[model samples]
Target: MKRRIVMSMFAGATLLASSLLGAAPARSADAPAEFGTDWHDPVTAAPPVAKPSGKSCQVTLAEAQFRDFTPYKGTYTPPEGCGERWSKVVLRMDGKVKGRQFDRLGHLHVGGVEIFRTSTPEPSPDGIEWSVEKDVTRYSDTFRRGQDVEMLIGNVVDDTYTGVIDVKVTLTFYAPSATAARPSATAASPVTNAARPATSTTRSTPTPDPTPDRVLTPDRVLTLQDGTVTTPRNSERIVAEVYATGSGGGCEEFWYLSAPDPAPYSCKAGDGPYREVQIEVDGRLAGIAAPFPHVWTGGWSNPFLWYVTPGPRAFDVKPIEYDLTPFAGLLNDGRPHRVEVSVVGVPEGQSGWSAPVNVLVWQDAKSAHVTGRLTGHKVGELANSSTYTPGSEHRVDTEGRHRLTVGGYVDTSHGRVTTTVSRSLTNTSAHRWTDGENLDALDAAWKDDQSVTVDGRGPARTTRTQRTYTMDGSITIGAGDRLRTVLTLGDRAAVGTTRAGRRIAWSWLDDTVEGDASWTLNVPRDQRHAVGTTSERFRLHGSKGCYDRSLTSVQGVLTEDRRAC
Candidate 1:
C-alpha cells in the first residue's frame, strides 16, 4: 500500500525558514496496494532561491486562510533595520490543508505590484503541507515602501469540497555584503533581470549582485483599465507581464486538446486549440507569445497521477513577460494608451481563461519628458489551421505560428537610444480519442523565440531568449474498467546575451516531469488500488553557474534524489 508521506517541501532555515519543517524523513514501509492519506508535500526539481549569507530582516506579509471568494487584505510595511537597500529579497509561503479540495489559483499584490502568482495543491483525506519560495528582489522598489496588500487563493468549502487553504507569506531581505558598494562587471547587464530564465534555471557559480545603481523596477505599476494604461512620461523601458491561466475546473483547463467543429472531443473550440497570448498597444500589435500549457493537479481525468508529484510548474506559476520597450516612445507621450492582452483562440466571451496584466516601466530619470516615436511596426498574418479525421480513434491535427517586429527610439538624458524587438511563436498538437472517450490523449509543443536589442552610446547590446514547452500524455480505461494515465512535460530554454559581436553571458535550462498511474475506474478510495510513479530532472549551465538535480517517486515514496553538475 502507499505510505503516508510526511515530508516538508522546505529543508529548514536553509531557505530563510528559520523555524520551518526539515526535509522528508525516510519513507515508511509500503502498505497494501492503495493510496495513502497524503503523499509527499508538493516539491519540484527547480532550484531554490539564492540568499546571501549576511544579516537579514523579515516582515510578515500576509497570514490568512482562503475560504469562499473573499480576499485577504492588509497593509505592508518595509522591514526596519534592513535599510532601504538590499542584496536580495525572497518570498516564502508555508501552507497546510486537510480534508478534500481541488487545486486553485492564487496571487499576491504588494503596493499594487504583482509579486507572486501560484496554484494550490489538491489535498488528501489525511491532510497535507507544502511550501514554496521565490526570489522577489526585482520588486525591491515596491517593497521598500509601505502599501496595501491583497492575496487570494479562491476556494469553496462544503461537505464535498472541504479543504481550507491555510497559508502564511513572508519576505526576507538580505543586507548587502561588504563589497555590495563596489561595482562589478555584469556579463548580462542590459536589462538587469532579463537574464533570469523563469523557473528551473540556476546560477552554477552565482555571485552576490551589487546593490542596484538605480532601483531596477517600474516607478509606477498600472493595471489595464478596460485594457488601457498611462505610462510614465519619461519611460525609458517598458515591460508587460501576463498572469495567464486556463482554468475553471473544465475542459478549457485542457485547452490544447480542444477539437474543432466536427472532431468529437470533450473540449471543443470552433477554431481548434491554437491559443496565443497577444498584446496590442495604442491600437497596434506590440507582442505575441504562446501561453504555457499548464496542467493543474486535477487534470487529465486523473488525480492519482499527481498526488505525489505535480507537473513541472504546478506550484510555481511564472508569468509570461513581454518586452514593451519598443513602445516606450509612444507611451511616454504622457497620455493613456490602449494596452490590451487577449488569448487568440478562446470562444468570443467564454470564461475559461483569466489573464490580468501588470505593466512595469523604467523611466529616464534625467529627463522631465522623453520624446520619440515608433519608427516601424510589422506583424505577419497569424497562421492557424486544423484538420480532423474520424475513425475508431478520432484525430485532430493543429498547427499555428506568428511573427512580430517592432522598432522605436527615445531621446534620453544620456543620448538617443534605439530599441528593437522581434518575436516569433509556434504551436503544434495532435489530439486523439475513442468513441466513448474511454481513450483520451494529446501531444503538443509550443515554442516562443525572442530577441531584444538596445543601441546607444556604447557597443550595441542584445539579449536573446528561446523557450520551449511540451506536453505528451494519455489517459485510458480498459479491461476491468481501470483508468490509467501516462504523461510527460518539458519546460526548457536557452538564453544568451551579446554586446557588439561578442557573446558575454549565456545559460541553458531544461526541466522535465513524467508520471504514470492506474486505478479502478469506479471504486472507492481504498478499493481503487492506485499505483503511480513520478520523476523530474532539472539542469542549468552557463556563465551564471551550473546545476543539475533529479527527483523520482514510486507510489508515495521518494526512491531517488540525485544531483550532478
Candidate 2:
C-alpha cells in the first residue's frame, strides 16, 4: 500500500479571514449545511455534506471568430495591456450537472470568512497566506471560489468520483494607489451589516467582471481585370473566370497608393462583384473590378492588386498584387520590390506587411580534424596522485576553430581519470600497455591495503589501487592528424574486467584533494586500463570525534591514445 502525508497551518486571530477558509455555504431548509462560519475548536466534530446523484453544472459558448474593430459576443473586461480585446470568444468546453449539484458541493463550506484584519497571517498547506512579498496592504484577506469542476474515474466505476473543483478568489484591502494617496477598492462590493439570519451567496459580493463575446465574419470574394490594357494600371482590375473552391476560407487583396502610408487594406472574403475603391487626389474612384474566384480559410487574408499616391492622393503611383507573381506590366516601373498589403471590408484593421523575404538567393564552408598523444602523470610517479590546478582547468584550441574547455581530475592511485571532452566519439578498438622497464605483463594483478576518514569520520580500509607511474619527455605518433580533426588525450589508460565484475588494471589523469594528509591519484598515457571508482567505510581510530566522515565518487571514460582497454 502507498503512504501519503499531509500538513496544515492555521491563523490564531480572526481578523482578515480572507487568508483563512471561509464559512460553508448557507444551508437551505431542505438540505444540510456543509460547514459553519465560526472557528472550530481543536476537537470540534466536522460537518458532513449531502451527496446527490448526477453532475453539478453546465457550460456554453457564444461565438466563434472575431475581427479587429468588430466586437465579440459579450462585453469582455479589457486585459491590463491594450491590443485587440476578444469580441467573441468560443466556449472551449461546457460543464453539465448530471443530476446532483450539492453532493460534493459541501467542500465549498468553510469557516472564519473574515480573519485577516487583526491576525498575523500564517502560511497554510491550503495556500492561505498574507502578502508579505510586496508592500501594499496590511489588513487583507484571501478567499477562493469555484473556477471549474469535473468528475474522475476509478478501477471498477466509471463515474464513482467527482472531478477537481477549481476556485478563484479576491483578497480585499486598501493600498497606496498609483498616485500615492490611499485608494478605495472600487471593484469590490461594500461590506454589509447583518440585519437578519445570515447567508452568503455567489451574488453576495459584486465585482467589475470582464467576460469575452463572440462574432463571425463571411468568406469569399470575386476579382476582375481590364482586358484592353497590355500592362494593367495601378488601379485596374480584370475579370477572372476562376471560381472560389469553398466556404470558411477568407480571401484578401493588396494594392498600393501614393499616400503618406501605402499599406494595403483587406476585404471580407465573399463572392464580390462589388465596386473596388481607388484613391486619387481629386477623390474620384480610380477603377472598376470584375470578380476573381478564390477560396478563404477562416481568418486568412490573401493579397490583390491596387494603387496609391503621395499625401493621401498625390504624385506617387504604385501597383499592388495579393500574391507576389511576375506579370509583364503589373509593375508600371517594371522593377522588383516588396509592398505593403491588407484587405478591405473586414472589421479587423488592415494588417502589417510581410517580412522582407529576398527573392534573390547563396553557399556555406567545410570542416576537418587533428590528433595528439595523451601525456601526463601524477605526483612524481608514486604513492599519491598528482593534483590538478585549482579547479582542474583543461582547454583545447585547434587553430582557427573554437576552443573547448573541459574540467576534471586524474586519480592515479586508483588507476583512473575523468575529464569533460569537447565531443563524444566511439573508440572502435585499442591495444598497447607499457608502464616501466620491468615490463610486467599487463595481465598481472595485485592489491593494496588502505583507509580514509574525512575530518575524523573513520579509517575505512580497501584494496583498489595497486600501480602508479610517470612520463617526463615528449612522445610522438604519426598516424592521423588533419587540421580538420581535433584529437586530445589529456591522459589515457586501458583496463580489463572479469565476467565476475572485478577491475583488473587502469590509469589516472588528474586529482583534487582537500584537507591535510589526504591523497589523490594520476597515471600516464599507455597504461591501457583507466577506470576509477570510490568506496567509503567508517572505522573509529580515536575514542571520540569519528562519526563526521563523508566520501563521494565520480566516474568517467579514458581515451585509447593513452592505454588499451
Candidate 3:
C-alpha cells in the first residue's frame, strides 16, 4: 500500500511569502516529534530491545531459518512511555534478501492476540529492499508497560529451503501534538446483551402460525438432498433462516499440522475462523456468511504447541446463523424460488470440511404481494462484484417528500451476500434563509442483512453466519447560511454456528459487539472551517461452552475481561 503525505495548513502561505521575498521559506511553529525506540540486530533471545532510542524501536534477524510449513517466533516490548498515544504507532517490516528463494507468511501479536498478518516478501531484484507498514494505533490498549509482544513467520512451501534473509522490525511513534490537527470519528456508546445459558439440543423445526401479522416459521427443512424450495404462497416480511456446520479438512487444519511426513492435524472443529458460505436465490447470488469463528470455544490450538500433540483428534460441532431478509421481496412472488448454498474458496478434496445446510422461510397473510427481481448484477475478483436491483422511488407532492429503497446481492470472495438500503428527504418552505432557495431537511436510513453456508467438503462439514446493520441520519441546510447534520447507527448484530454432524458443538451471538457511533457536523455562515464531532462506544460479548469474554472501549480507552461458564 502507498502512504499519503499531508502538507501542514500553513504550506500555501509559506510558499507565497518565500516567492515574494526571494528568500527561503521560514519553518512553521510546530516541531517534528518521535516517540518509540529502534532495534538493529537479530532477535534470538529475551530483552529483544537493542539500542533504545526513546520513542522509536527495531528488531533484526540476520540469518533467520524456517523449514517448510513450520513457523518461527520472535518477541519484543514497547517502551512504557508509548502508552495512550494511540494515533502515532506504526509497525514496519523491512526484508533484505540474500538468496532468491523466499515464500512465507508473517504475523504480529500483542500479549496473546494476533494483530497483523501478511505474505512473505516477494523476491526482489538484486540490491532492492522489500518492506511493508501497518498502522497499529487501533490496538493501543495492548501496548502497556512490560507487556510481551510476539512475531511469527511461517515458510509455506511444500519442501525445505535454506537461505539468508536479513529482516528488521521497526516501531515508530510520534508526539501527541503532531496528531492534534487530524479529525477522527468518535467511538459509539456500548450496549450489552444478557448471556444465554449453555444448552445443546436437536435442531428446532418451528411451524408457521396462521395469523396475518405474526412471526412466521419455516414449515419445511432443506438439506443437501433438499436444497431447493418454492414458496407455498405469497407472503410479506419473508426471511430465509440458515444453519450450517463445518467439519474436518479445512485451512486451519492445514496451517497447524506438523508431523509424520503427512501429519494429521488435531484441534476442535470450530477452531478455524476463516470458513465462508454463499447463498444463491433462483440461480442468482443472494447472501454470504464469512468466517464467523467460535472465539470462546477453546477450539483454537496454539501453533507453538504443535510438538505436544501431533495427530488428529475427534472433533466437535459448532453452529452459525445468517439472515436473508434483503431478498424477501423476490421470494414473495409465490414462485418456486431456488436457493443454493456453497462454501467459498475451499477447493474440492483438499479438506473433508462439508457444510450441511437447513433453510426455512417464513410468511404472512400479505404473501404474494411483493415483487422484485435481481437486476444490474455484476461479479469480479474477490471484492469486486455486486448483485442487486434498483428499488422503488417515491415522491409525495403534498408533503414534499422523496423516498428510495434499494436491495440486492453481492458476490465477493468472502461469499455471495445480500443487502437493503433506503433514504428519504423532506423539503419545507417554513423558514427564511440567507440564499434565495428555501431551506431543506433530509433524513436517510440504510440497512443490510447477509448470510452464507460454507462447504468444508466432508459430510456435515459446514459453517453458517449472518450479520445485519442499520444506519440513519438527518441533515438540515438553511439556504447556505448554516448546515447541520447528525448520523446514527441504530443496530448491528452478527450470530453464527459450527456443526460437527447432527448437533451444535459451538455457537455465538455478537451484536454491535463493540460499539456504535454517530457524527455531527455544523458550519456557521461565512465560517472558514466546519466544526465536527464524532461520539462512539464499543463493546463485544461472546460465549462458548461455559467460558465468556467481553471487550469494551470508550473514546479511545479499551478494557477486556473474561469469565468461566
The numbered model that scores best in TM-score is 1
Q: Kindly list the per-residue Cα lDDT of model 3 for residues 325-364, writing each as its tens digit.
A: 4565566555566777765434444453334344443333
What C-alpha lDDT does candidate 2 achieve relative to the native structure?
Answer: 0.15
Q: Best candidate per lDDT, number? A: 1
For model 3, the run of ten residues with the poorest summed lDDT = 12-21
Candidate order by TM-score, decreasing, is: 1, 3, 2
Root-mean-square deviation of Cα positions for candidate 1 versus the true structure, in angstroms: 5.8
Which pairs clash inside model 1? 1-31, 1-32, 204-545, 204-546, 205-545
For each candidate, the alpha-carbon lDDT, in order, equals 0.73, 0.15, 0.30
| Residue 19, model 1, lDDT | 14
Instruction: Estimate TM-scores for all models.
Output: 0.90, 0.12, 0.28
Tell me how candidate 1 scores on lDDT: 0.73
**In each prediction, how many residue pairs overlap at the backbone (N, C-alpha, C within less than 3 A)?**
5, 119, 63
Writing each residue's lDDT as its tens digit, candidate 1 over 60-154 gives: 99999887878899999999998988888888899999988877777788876677876776788888888888777767778877999998888
Candidate 2 lDDT over 1-565, as tens digits, reads 0000000011010111111111222222121121111111110001111112222221221222211112112212222222221111111111122210111101011121111111111111122211211111111111121222211110110242222222222211121223433221111111100000111122222111110000011011111111111212221111111111111112221111001111111222221111121111112111111111111100001000000000100000011111111111232222332222122222244332111110100000010111111221111111211111111211111110111112222222222222221211111111111221111001111111111101101121111111111111111111231001011111111112121233322222111111111111122212212122221211111111111111222121011111111
Tell me the spans in candidate 1 whose CA falls farther than 4 Å from its real position.
1-32, 181-219
